[model samples]
Target: MENKKELRNWLNKMELAHPLVIAGPCSAETEEQVLNIAHQLKDTDATVLRAGIWKPRTRPGNFEGVGALGLKWLQRAKNETGMLITTEVASPTHVDLAQKHDVDIFWIGARTTVSPFIVQEIAEALRGTDKPVLIKNPVNPDLALWLGAVERFYEAGVSNLGVIHRGFSTYEKTRYRNNPEWQIPIDLQNRFPDLPLILDPSHIAGRRDIIFDLCQTALDLNYDGLMIETHNDPDNAWSDAAQQITPETLDQITVDLRIRKEEGDAVEFRNKLATLRTKIDVVDHKLLEILGKRMKISDEIGKLKKDNNVAILQTRRWNEILGKMILEGEEQNLSEEFVLRIYKAIHQESINHQKKVISN
Candidate 1:
């Protein structure tokens, strides 16, 4: 964990044109399937081929995975395509089998990353090896748990480490399969600037249509790489079919993506950006002042309601406020989702103030 420079060594070793691209099928269905996808991705931006060997499905009666047999397929694919092969290792046995088959890299999936015991087991299994390990974020949005998984690997002497931000699960309905609580990964980057952070747009999008945009966003945010699910025939893929894109589509997405520079050295650009940021700072301060004044009014209303013996939560009034704000937000080109989130937080704060007044 302390040796930050060592953790990024693997990424430094990779010779890639467009950041590091790890592309392959969601699951290794067969030797032919794995090999075909690997061959198609060989000439693309993808330098590492990833396939789920021991897939951990949410429910039973699904194609879990090809098990250890798929590792052989991955090995064969690597041999033919000359691309490094990677697979998900949930258990110590998986690590043993993957190592036996000469798999080049191992990634801990979201499910496995959530459990410290499993992560520890896999880390212990990989104790002496120097294989590059990529860990996906946990199912929930817990940054500490995700960082702990990485620390476990580092403690086990696995220095070649990276993280995959595949988004997080939430009960609330969202356009994305997983809510890309982008701040979590951004915070992680701020904490560990040396550790490479890759974006898993496939899991985050859960559909191919938005993968290109998501990739562009991640690249703009300075992610180290991307792990996209690419298949030979995406429509008929066994698992997560909707999220998988054809190898050709992946190629085009990589081509179309605009990778922005992290920072500019020009003094003029810096001055202009600083001026714009100062303007934003002023607006932010004014916004906070307005919010504080609104909360004071809310407290006054709460005291009035308490004196009148009226309920604090006026459902109809809340609905009206939300509808009005959403309409006004749309007029200003703001998304309903963004407006809802902002208003909901404010509403909760107001409720908290009312609760305190009522209790007193």
Candidate 2:
């Protein structure tokens, strides 16, 4: 841990620039494909050329990347273009190959981030190495699990670490393939203030048409950089054709982003805003006081139900409460859906209290 702190300070001294762009094909399909895309991106503001050498697919018989052989292509691209190379490494052997080929940066994918065992193994391999690493959030929304992965890497002596917010899978159908629960990453920033956060706009948007908007939003939120998927020819790309952008499109997007920088005096306002949060703390205390009184009322009702041999859950009463609250909150400009959810939770908890009292 101490060494990790020392390394983090050293990294801070180096101070890699913000808005660092990482771009390449989704997968290194062939030597020519990998080299061609890298050459095209060479002129762009891309800080690192990334390609997936070993893709962990949800199903078999899909393009699972080119495996170990693809590292050679990435090496050649780095050698020719003088551009830093990055690739996803799923296992210790993958890390070994990346190190052997002198790969500049490595990222652990969302699928791999879900498993602590895999992350630990990869971290052990990275121990004592000076190479920089990027850890993506898991496919699911688990902030603790994501932080745990980062801690494991830090504990294993990998100090130069970064986070990638790639969005999370959700059941709801929406424009995004993964819902950008921006709050989770914002919370992560609070916990690790020194760590750099990058946005994986391609994964979040899941469509080329919306990539620029997502990237712009990420920048507005003060993210350190973006990781976008680029292919020389998106029409002929082997994986994620719909999400891949051509080199020309990538260049335009870069130019467009420069013209859209976040508006004035965020840093000074944020410092003063921290002091204003004490007001929120006082209100929070009052809110808790009100909730305590509400819970006491619920306890009294539970006792009444117990004495009368009445059922704990009254469906008609719950329906009435929900209907009334939804209408009332809507009149106050609150979302009806939000009111329904909050009231239902309260109703369920009230029933649970009644059950406990009756059983006693």
Candidate 3:
């Protein structure tokens, strides 16, 4: 990964406003569709026009992009609108074709980012090119894998790099199409302070109604920009229609989003914030100590279970504990969702401890 200074230099070269927006359809259905949407997004906050030329859908028999032909449409759109063009590249061939079409930027989709071999191949293809490359986080919330992909690109002499947090897939039903495990990206930002971290709100939201709110949250979290899926007629779009929005709606979202300052400039505000942060530090330390003690007790229970030849996962007992905790958490002003996530993690750790004891 590039250092903060090097990443800052990359950002400076882009010369973008505070939140650089990249907007276009999820897929390039046709030349007219691509060009029309590009025209609509021309005056918006969007600086880059993006469309998927080679979409890798989960299921077969879907409107997988317009193939290499779409690159020409993207080129035409760029010529007409004067907007930089970007697209998802899954292979070395994609990189070659995109370079041939003079595509301004390239991003690796979540599916492609998960595979080291594919990333390496694409990185090899882009070895000498200085075009900006944005890598989406893997389908699963694996930070190490995501970081590895970025490092692979960086090692391959790709200096102009960025990351896209498109959220992570989960089997459980959620309000979101993918769970916006915001902490993963926030942790990434903490690790690489200068890395350009963009959020894909359309994918996270899965519905137009919540896109604006998701974009606002991302900006509030100090995200570098947003990549919203835009289309002329989203309701009848080829794929991911529910998540795509019209360019007019994209304009409104960008206009209404309030970008926040990274930190307060006032001395009093800084001093007060530091004091509050110290208090939080103390509370967090205490919380960790308590969790450590709980885990130690869990280890003891694991030993006892092993001695008694009892299974580690007592489903009935776990259900009872979860039920009790949810009610008690409500009294303590904690949401059931929050309590469940915490306990689920703790229970997994307890199971791991039991497994170790049983193995021994």
- Residues 126-156 of candidate 1 have per-residue lDDT tens digits of 9967888889999999999999999999889
Which candidate has the highest TM-score of all? 1
Superior candidate under TM-score, 1 versus 2: 1
lDDT of 3 at 28: 96
lDDT of 1: 0.87
Candidate 3 residue runs with Cα over 4 Å from true position: 1-14, 261-264, 267-360
Once superposed on the true structure, which residue ranges of model 1 sit more than 4 Å away at CA? 1-8, 12-14, 261-264, 267-360
Which candidate has the top score in lDDT? 1
- Please give the CA lDDT of all the candidate structures: 0.87, 0.83, 0.87
lDDT tens digits, residue span 34-131, model 3: 99999999888888999999999999998888899999999999999888999999999999899999999899999999999999999999996677
Backbone clashes, candidate 3 = 0
Order the numbered candidates by lDDT, best leading: 1, 3, 2
Shift in Å, residue 320, candidate 2 = 9.3
